[model samples]
Target: MKFFDVFLKQFRLQWRQYLVASLASYGSLCTGMSMGWTSPVLPQLRGPNSPLPEQPTLQQESWIGSLLVLGGLIGPFITVPLSKHVGRRWLIMGSNVPLLLGWLLAGVTTNLPTLYVARLAWGCATAMQFATVPIYIGEIAEDKIRGALSAFFLLFINIGFLLAYAIGPFTSYWGLTACGGIISLLYLPFSWYLPETPFFLVFKGRLEEASSVLQQLRGKTKDEVQPELDSLQAMIAREYEEEPKISDLWASRGSVKALGICVFLAMLLQLSGIDVLLFYMEELLAKVGTKISPSDGTIIMGVVQVATSCVTPMVVDRLGRKLLMWTTSLGLTIFLTLIGVYALLDNYYKYDVTSVTFLPLLCLIVYMILFTLGVGPVPWILVAEMFPLKTKCLASGICSFMCWLAGFIWTRFFRDVAASYGIYTAFWILAVCCGIGFIFSVALLPETKGKTFDEIQDLLNNRTKQGNPGA
Candidate 1:
């Protein structure tokens, strides 16, 4: 059978579960919508068609960008605590209120202070998303399709981005803000139709509700779900066996192991210099003496990014996570090395280097495609998959917190690091980090392609029992 035909047949068996996916993916869409608006709207604010009487000064623009990060630093404080007590479903739905308000705030006011507040609100919405959605998907999806489903978080993120880039350039100021309002409004009913994850219900000791939801999710009769339900109960029982004592840094040997992987993946995602490529593509291209316009270079990179995202959900289950991550990290190392070498020759060695200008652009294009294939989506999936139920709430919170913290520090210091050390030195640093990350991934990253949540947790606990065959 053809691929779409086969996929549709599978969809028939599991379409409701995918409605769950659709609900989860709206967070990603909201996130991408927020991200996409900034690029187009910022220019509109400053252009001859200024929304305000006076355009924002350069410092104001810079703070507007950084304020989101500042609010992002704080947003998880709300999500981590509230999500643990209130459950995943509402926090996701609650995140949208901010998204709607933030955009509406933008639509109504051109005031910088109000814009700053809206940007902060949007940042919180983004954090709520990164914190909640993957865990929900991990809890609900069957092991057979977990990687692909978790990947929807990222696929929709880029789709939001592409939609913003494609549509925002042409739309009016009010229309741009309306876009976010529309997505937020649509998410309400779609999210309502989805079930709360069985794990959450079980964790709360609502066993009957848990079983009912699991029956709906698994599309099996109660007798068929008994073994799976038992596994979930056992996992939950063990997790709450005693009130969990908070370790210093919440460190259990098992959690430490899981955290080490989260840290490495987070580091790989940020330190691969993906941010440098995205935010400063044009500037870097100029430094390399490329004839390509910054806009064209950015457009090319964006196209390659969206194109590569499509490749993962199809192949991740087939090829597995470890191979793709290792390959992409290694690829990043190679391309970054080439770009760094070219920069080295140009700046310090005084090689005119005009002839090889295309090399850096080529390296960036290939580097972005490779980056999207693995580093972009896999980390979030691993974060969702690797934790035990006992620690899933706190562990995911800390893990995502560190991610935002890393992003803030990296973006803040990257320019200083470049200015003080020179751009070639910066690329070389990112290249060295990628080279080291390749070794780290090879040594420690878990292969989670087909494993159940219990199996992955067992691996974390260093126990050696076979998982439920049904899982």
Candidate 2:
């Protein structure tokens, strides 16, 4: 069959799975993007022209930023256990309630305390979606399409970033918050249509429900469903039989190695300074003596984000995760370093407008393109695939917590860092972080492309055996 014919047939047969995956993915993306929107506004929200109090200094802003990070740290601890007890669908759907209310409250609040509460609430809702959605997608997708389907999380996140970046600067805070409320509305209809993950259903011992979802997802008849269901049941049974405890995560050499890899990868992605760039684009642009208005700069940033996001999925599987990440990180490091040097030259050496204006913009564009292609998508993909089934939730939860904590650190500090150290110096620090990321990717990270979950688990187990020499 032609590719489109196959796609249409699959959609027709598995509309429910598609709908569920799309909705889950969309909700996750919306929450992530909502947070991205506020990055640029933090300074403005606390500036002298702002309506809020001035008693809290930049140091206080950092403290408030930590609250957002603290929310991320707390969420997975709360939600992951709940997901095992309840179900992914409801947990995911329910998260929207706080996200919607948080943004609405934030938009209307004048008090700093109320705004912090809203941010904390928003962070909790975002963490819930983050923890559940990938697991949902992993459990629902067939082995053949799992990687491609998983990429949807990153793709939609970029879409969210693009939307927020485009809309944020053009409108008032209230209008932007309203946009978040509208996006939150999408979660309701999604909850109505989304199916419980087949893995979760199977885990619950609902064989018939699992079988039905399998048939729907594969566009298969009852005959075709049995083999897949049987395979899944066997896999789940084996996993539960040898379930690894949280203690096993640090005690086992292989598990510890995998955990370290995930944490490092996630931290590298955050500390690479992409969040700071996205969040502080207006300020960064102004720092370089560029005349572009905040609204126009944001629109430009949005366009670059969307344009580069399209490149990752097409080449992710083909390029292999390690190569893509290393190449992108190296490229980003080079471009960022050059941008910093140029900015320094602009400040110190008095370059002409032509050289100063277009060069830095070109470098920034290159940095964005490199980021989307490699670092943006690879960390999530790797984290999702790296862990064994038993450790998946706990490991992912820890990794995501670290990721958010890193985000909180960068968002909280970048403004003050820029103010104190200069934008050029800040970019230099980020360039160094990107360089370190490249080194780690080359030395430590393993290739996971085209590997099934079973194969990955076996590999890790074998490595554990080799390392222990006894077990």
- lDDT per residue (tens digit) for residues 76-189 in model 2: 876767766788788887887778877787777877888788778877887776777777787887654565566677667778777777777666666676787788787788
Regions more than 4 Å wrong, model 1: 1-12, 52-59, 171-175, 248-251, 279-289, 342-361, 416-422, 461-471
List the candidate 2 regions with Cα displacement exceeding 4 Å: 1-19, 39-67, 242-244, 461-471
Candidate 1 lDDT, tens digit per residue, 370-423?
887788788888888877666666667776777767666665566667667877
**Best-fitting candidate, scored by lDDT:** 1
The clash count of every prediction, one per candidate, is 0, 0
Enumerate residue pairs that collide in model 1. Answer: none
Give the lDDT of residue 319 in candidate 2. Answer: 66
